[model samples]
Target chain A: MLAIRRTAPDPDGRLTGIEIADRPAPPRPDGWTTVRLKSASVNHSDLAAVRGPGFEPGTHRVLGIDGAGLDEDGNEVIVYPIVSGPGYADPLYDPDLRALSQGLDGTWAEEVHVPRANLIPKPAGLSWDHAACLGTAWLTAYRMLFGRADLKPGETVLVQGAGGGVSTALISLGVAAGLRVWVTSRDPDRGERAVTELGAHAAFSPGARLPEQVDAAMDATGRATFAHSLRSVRTGGRLVTAGAVTGGTTDLDLADLFIRSISLHGSAMGSPTDLRNLARHCATGGARPKIDSTWPLHDAKPGIARALAGDQFGKIVLHCA
Target chain B: MLAIRRTAPDPDGRLTGIEIADRPAPPRPDGWTTVRLKSASVNHSDLAAVRGPGFEPGTHRVLGIDGAGLDEDGNEVIVYPIVSGPGYADPLYDPDLRALSQGLDGTWAEEVHVPRANLIPKPAGLSWDHAACLGTAWLTAYRMLFGRADLKPGETVLVQGAGGGVSTALISLGVAAGLRVWVTSRDPDRGERAVTELGAHAAFSPGARLPEQVDAAMDATGRATFAHSLRSVRTGGRLVTAGAVTGGTTDLDLADLFIRSISLHGSAMGSPTDLRNLARHCATGGARPKIDSTWPLHDAKPGIARALAGDQFGKIVLHCA
Candidate 1:
C-alpha cells in the first residue's frame, strides 16, 4: 500500500520528516477490519507529532489521523481516529489514548485497519474529501464549540488564528448553526477572507480589541492568542482549545479568569456521539469543511508541507485511492 | 455608633490598618433604609481590601461585608452587602459592582444603610453571627459549589485551603449537602481539624496526591493552590475560585485543562437568588459557618488584627449592640 510515514524530527525547522512510500497491508485484528481508504486530511496533530518529539531513528510511523473509505462490506464510511484506548474510556482523558498515527498504522495508505465501531456510515452526497476531514480537525471544532462550550445559536463566538483547519471549521460550523461568528488572524488577508468567504460576521488582527466580548471563543493558537481570546470572551463565557501550535503554556491571570467568571475548556477530538451529529450536520447542508487543496495520494508531500508551514487557510486533503 | 474602618495599607505587614471608633449614625436615603446591625463578620474581602490597595491615609472605609440586623420596621434581617451596582446588575459582572465597602460604607458599623431589598428575614432560630457570615464568604462558597461549579450531593469536592473563611464554609456546606468533602492545608493541624472538626472525609497536605480525583474543587488560595486544584479534578470536573490571598497569577497548562476537560469558574459572591437559597439552607440547618471567635463591638480591633494576620481558622465576628 502507498502511504505517508513520519521519518525524522523537524525540530530545528528543517521540515524534512514525511516519507511517501509503499507499506505492508494492515492486518485485521480480532475486532478490526480493513477499509479501502478513499481520502484523508492533514491536521496539526499529524504535523505536530513530527515537529515535536520525533520518532526514534529507525521507526517510520504511518501518518494520518482521519479518513473516508469503503469498508470490507462495501459500505462508505468515515473512520473514527481514536483507537479506543484500554477500558473504552473517552480517548482524550485516557493516559494511553492514541489516534490513528500515534500507535497504529494510519489511513494515509490505500488500505487501513480500524475497529468495526470506528466506521460511521458516510451520508450519500457528502464528498470523500469533506468526510475525510470530519473525524479529526472538524470533529475537534465540533466538540470545542458544541460539546465543550455548549454554544447556542444567536450567541457570539470568537475564533483565534484564522488560517488553521480547526479555526476554519469553527467559522463554517458556527455560522451554519446561526451564531454570530467572529474570527481573528495575524494576517489581515486571512481575516478578511474569513469574513468575506467563510461567513464570519467580522474578523480582526490578532490582539486587536474585538468590537465586543463574545459569548464564547475558540483557540488553537496557544501562547500567542490565548490571553487575547481569554479577554475577548464576555464575563462568564468560555474558550475551548484543541491544539496549541505556537506554544502550550500561558500565564493564567487568576483574577481575570475567575473574577470575570471566565472558563476555558481544552478539547482534543469529538466523542462518537459528536461524530454522528457532525456527519448529520454536514449532510443536512448545515456547513462544509473548507478544502484548501487536494492532491493525489502519491502527491501528498506538497499538501502536507503547506499544512505543516501553517500557510493553508482550510483543511488540506489527499485523495488516497 | 461604633464601627471598624480601614484607614490605610498594611503593606509592610504591620497589621495596624484597622481602627475601631465611634461614627455618626447611618443616614437612610430614598430607596434605602437603616439596618441596626447586631453582628458583622470579618471576611477575607475585608482583610484583603486592607492588605492590597489600601485607602488614602485620610480616608476611612467601614470594613465588614455582611451582617445580621434589624430593619427600619424593626424586622430582624440579614443585610445583603452588594449595593446594587449602577443598573442593579449582577454585582459579579458589573464593572461598577460595589459590594458595600468598595465604595460606600459597609456593614462593620452599629447601623448600616442599605436598599430595602437588601434585607432577608432572619430565621428565628438562626444566630446573628452565622447570618452575619453569609453575605460574603459563605455566600461566595455557596455560589462556588452550587452556582458556578454546579456540584451535586453524593459527589466528591476538594477544598484547596481548609482554614480560610470560604474554604471552611465549603467544607461545612458541602458535607451538609451530602457531599464527600476533602480538604488540603499547609498546616498539618488545619488539615486534621478540617477532617475531625469540620466533617471532611479526608485531609491532604497541599499538592498531595489524592486517593482519587474529585468531582469538583473550591479554590481561594490562588497562585499557591490553583495549579494543584486544576490537577485534582476528574475529567470534565470544575473548580470555583473566589479570592487569591497567596497572589493572583498561575501557570495554566492548557493541555492539562482541556485534555482532561477541567473547568475553572471564578466566583465573586452569590446572586440575590443564591443569597436567598443560602439563607434557606442555613435556616434548615444544612450547615453552620464555623465561628472562630467573637469579640465585643468595642474590641473589634483585635479581631481585625487576627483576621488580617490569617491566624484565625473560621469566620471572626464583631458583636455589635
Candidate 2:
C-alpha cells in the first residue's frame, strides 16, 4: 500500500514536507475496522499539519483528515475522524478528544483503521469524493451554520472569506437550508464567483459595510475578519468561528458584546450527530461538495501545492481507486 | 430638590466631579410620569459617569441607574432605566436604546421622570433600597444567570469578584435558583464573608484554579478576570459579562474558544421583563440585595467615596425619603 505522509513540517506552510511512499497496510485493532480508501479530500487542517507544530517532532505521519471507502463486508462508509474514550456518547464533550493527523496517522492511504463507531454508511446519492469532503470541512461548516448558530430559514448569514473549503461549504449549505447567504472575499474575482457558482445571494469586498445587518455571520478568517463579523451582525445575532486562517488573536470589545446582546460561539469540527445530519441533508437536497481539483493518490504533491496556494475555490481531493 | 450630579467630565475616574446640589424638578413628558425617589443604589455605571466619558461634558446630569420610587398614582415602583423608541417591545434590539444617566437625567434626584411603561410595581415584600438595587445590578445579574447563560439547576456557576454589586446579586440569585455558586475575590475577608452571608458554596482568590470546573462563569471585573473566567468554565459552558469595572478590553484566544466549544455572551442592564421577573423572584424566594451602607441624599459624597475605593461588600445606596 502507498500512503502520503509528512516527513517533517514545512516552516512556510508549503507542500515541501509531503511525500508519497510505499507503506504497510494499517492494522485492525480489536474493536476497530479497516477501510479500503476510494477517495480522500484535502482540508485546511491537512495543510496546517504540513505547515507545522501539529504532529510530533520526528515521526512520519500519514496526513489526511477526511475520506470515504469500502469496509470488509464491501459496504461503502464515510469515516468520522475523532477518536475519544469508551462510552463517550458525544465526542465533543470528551476531554481527551483528538482527531486524525494531530497525534495519529490519518486517512491519505490505501487502507486506514478507525473505531467501528466512527464509520457512517455512505448514502448512494453522494459520490465517494463528496462523502470524503464531509468528514472535515463540510461537517465543520454544517455545525457552524446549523448546530452552533441555529440559523432559521429566511434569515441572512454573512460568510467571511469567500473561497476556502469552509466558506464554500457554508454558502452552499446555507443556501440549500433556505438562508439568504452573503459572502466576502479579499479578491474581487473570488467574491464574484461565490455569488455565481456557490449560490450566494450576494458578495462584497472584505471588511466592506454590509448593505444591511445580517442575522448571523460565520468567520473562519480570524483577526482579519473578526471585527467585521462583530460589527455586521444585527442586535442579538450570533457569530460562529471554526478556524482562524490568518491569525488566532483578536481584540474583543466587552461593551459592544453585551450592549448589542451578540453571542460569540466557538465551534470546532462537530459531533457524529452533526455529521449524520449533514450527510442526510446533502443526499436528500441534491447538494454536492464542490471540488477544486482531484489527483491520483501517487501524484498528490501538485494537489497539495494547489491547496497551499489557496487559489482554488473548493475542496481538493485525491482519488485512491 | 436635592440631587447628586456630575458637574463635569473628569479625565480620571474620581468623585471630584460629583456634587450634591439643589435642582429644579424635572417636567413630566406627555407619556411619562414622575417618581418621587425613595431610594437609589450606586452602581459601577454611576461611578463611571462620575469618573468620565460615559456622559456628556459640561452638563450637570443626575447620576444613578438603579432606583425605587413612588409613581404619580402613589404606588411604589422600580424604574427600568433603559429608554427606547416608541412601540419597542425589546429595548435590547432597539437601535436607539439609551439608559438613564447616559444622556438623560437619572434617578439620583429627589424626583425623576420615566416613561409609564418602564415602571414595574414594587411588591410590599421588598424594602425600597432592595427594590432600587433591582434596576441595574440585580437585573444585569439575573439576565446573566438565567437569560443569557440559560443555566439549569444543579449546574455550578463561578461569579468572579465577590465584593461588587453584580457579584453579590449573582451569588444570591444563583443560590436561590438552585445553582452551586462559587465566587472569586482578591480580599480574603470578602471571600470569607461571601460564603457566610451570601450562601456561596466556596470562594477563591482571584485567578486561583478552582477545585472543579463550573458550568458557567460571570465576569464583571474586565481585563483583570476575563482570562480566569475563560479558563475556569467547563467545555461548552458559557461566560457572560455586563460591566468591566477595571477595564473593558481583553485578549480573546480564538483557538481556545473554538476547540473548547465555549460561548461568550455580552449582557447589559436587562429588559423590563427581566426586571419584573427578578423582583418577583427576590420577593418570593426571600433573596434580598445586600446593602453595604446607606446615606441621606444630601450626604452621598462619602458613600460615593466608599464605592470608588472598592472596599464595599454590596450596593451603596442613597436614601431620599
**TM-score per candidate, in order?**
0.83, 0.82
True contacts kept of 2: 0.81
Q: What C-alpha lDDT do the candidate models reach, one value each?
A: 0.82, 0.87
For candidate 1, give fnat to 2 decimals: 0.65
Cα DockQ of the candidate 2 complex:
0.63
How does candidate 2 score on lDDT? 0.87
lDDT of 1 by residue, B1-321 (tens): 788777778765455777788877656678888888999988766777867874766778787788898987888899888765554346566655667887778888888888887788888778998888899778888989988888888889999987777788899889888899999989999889998888999999999999998888888888988878888888768888777888897887787776776777778887777887898888885588878899888877777778777788677898888
Q: Give lDDT tens digits, candidate 2, residues B113-186.
A: 88998999898999999999898878889999999899999999999988777888899999999999999999
RMSD of 1: 4.4
What local lDDT does model 2 show for residue A252? 89
Cα lDDT of model 2 by residue, A258-306, tens digit: 7788899999888888888899889988778888899999998888888
Superposed Cα deviation of residue B289, candidate 1 (Å) = 1.3
